[model samples]
Target chain A: MVSLYFLLFYINILLIGCVLVYIYKLRKLIGFQLGMTISMVAGGFFAFTSGIIFIYVYPFHFLPVTIAATLLGMAVGSIFGSFFDYQTLLSGYSNGLMMGMMSPMVGAVAKNSFLFLSFAECLFFASLLLVLSSARQT
Target chain B: MILYLYTMLGINILIPAVLFLTMKKKRKLFTDRYGMTISFSASLIFSLSLGTALFFTLPVSFSVLIFISAAAGSIIGLSYGILITFQSLIIGLFNGTIGSLMGTMLAAVIIDPSLCGLPSQFSTLLDRNIILITLFLTLLSLLSSLLLRFSYRV
Candidate 1:
């Protein structure tokens, strides 16, 4: 049987690719609403960038680490002005996939630390949310 | 609503869950994007709900709690008539950990010193085991629904 790490790595990459394709096809629908498109792109960018960062900085801190960032990105994007659109759906799924395949290595640096990661992600997402959303809206 | 919550308790988890229980026929080259979206979001919400519960209710700390919740959440996600694609499982596991992490933070607000960013004694009364766990678990589970997908391409 294949090791969980390698399995997750390849699978996450595949998911990311599929999401990109979906985004490409739904570009018009996403673009229809500027707010949703930007947020979706922001989420995807965060997910991809965070994945790369985790692979380098903390190779073992896969899922939660990357997910924390992606979720933060999505959270920020949605707060701006979310709607039921292709972009919104695809972005959420992409981020979800990123988190799912996050290395499955919960014990790399620390296990319990994920709580902290969530806090950090929330902080970042909240910060981004502040910028994306107005006091009246959010 | 109650059925979904019961799944979080791992009580009658096998029954009403069948509502979300789905089976995958195939992942086609030209797959129905909307359907995939439905599957992904459904599993995500389920994993997130159970994961948050695991972290909030368990006697363990965040590290251990996350592992347990992630495993259980992934299982719950996989059980949803998914085609068992590797991609889907990854997504589910991610939801689980993220949910657990959120729960841990909510609890840590009063329990974990390094967390909370507040004085523990100030919130001692709010830190009761049952109360805190129940409050955190319910709030997270319900709030997570807002993130669920409702619209899909038909």
Candidate 2:
């Protein structure tokens, strides 16, 4: 049943959330609540976006939607990167992997170079946002 | 066709995973209430603009009625995206850009599957299946968020 899939999906999400919370608590012990918050907010944002995309965007094969999502992530990541003590290099790496995974999807659906480029732009912008945020913080 | 589905599915998984990983490393970064709020708001606005753009671009027609409907649908989608994004932001929650993008794309795929110039048979099937899958994934994300909220309650 479709509801079953939905149930599984939610269960996985809950588990992930719990883990993140646990990690946040651990990080809190070290006075890194800021980092934890950033990560939580980012995760929340991702989950929200994923839901929206599933409900609306992919059916039509819109390129801008992906671009916008990537841009938002970059913005969030950049903010986190700027103020936190840790380097966002890892964030960048993760984003890159995501971007790589996404390219083929966009290509398959939209087949537009502009869409692909937008995804790339999002990653670059996210990296920039992180760096800028870090600079501003320091 | 399968490639497209797999890629979309992969993105669905990866976006959340990456966000979770990022948060696991730095939850405090989100505590800046102002910044998170702003980012969330911006994402909502971005989603609206994208939805609007999609509504207008697809369903290309030489006919007046079709054009009018397309324009109207674009407006509706844009408004809906904004509404949903804003609601989600208020709760100190967020989804990644990819998810938003996917939402818009899913809309387009449904409204204008032929726009991509795919073979009609494959695109149609893909479009329908994607809609189902996206729904499943969205539900999953919401459930996960709820779980996170409950589990993290101190």
The candidate 2 chain A region of ten consecutive residues with least summed lDDT is A88-97
Looking only at chain A, give the TM-score of model 1 against the true structure.
0.36
lDDT of 1 by residue, A1-138 (tens): 124434544554464444444444444443334434444444544454344435434443232353455454455344322444654544454443434233223223233344544453454355345424432242
Which stretch of 10 consecutive residues in model 1 chain B shows the poorest summed lDDT? B21-30
Instruction: List each candidate's DockQ score.
Output: 0.06, 0.06
Please provide, for model 1 over B1-154, each residue's C-alpha lDDT reduced to its tens digit, 9 standing for 90 to 100. Answer: 2344344466323321544422333334224443344445555555544554555445676578767766766665555425545555556555545544543443343244333222234344443443434444344334434443223222
How far is B101's C-alpha from truth in model 1 (Å)? Answer: 4.3
Candidate 1 residue pairs that clash: A63-A102, A99-B94, A100-B90, A100-B94, A111-B63, A112-B63, B22-B81, B23-B81
Q: What are the per-candidate TM-scores when only chain A is compared? A: 0.36, 0.35
Give the runs in model 2 whose Cα sits over 4 Å from its true position.
A1-137, B1-105, B117-119, B123-131, B151-154
Q: How good is model 1 by TM-score?
A: 0.45
List TM-scores of chain B, every candidate. Answer: 0.54, 0.32
TM-score of candidate 2's A chain against the true A chain = 0.35
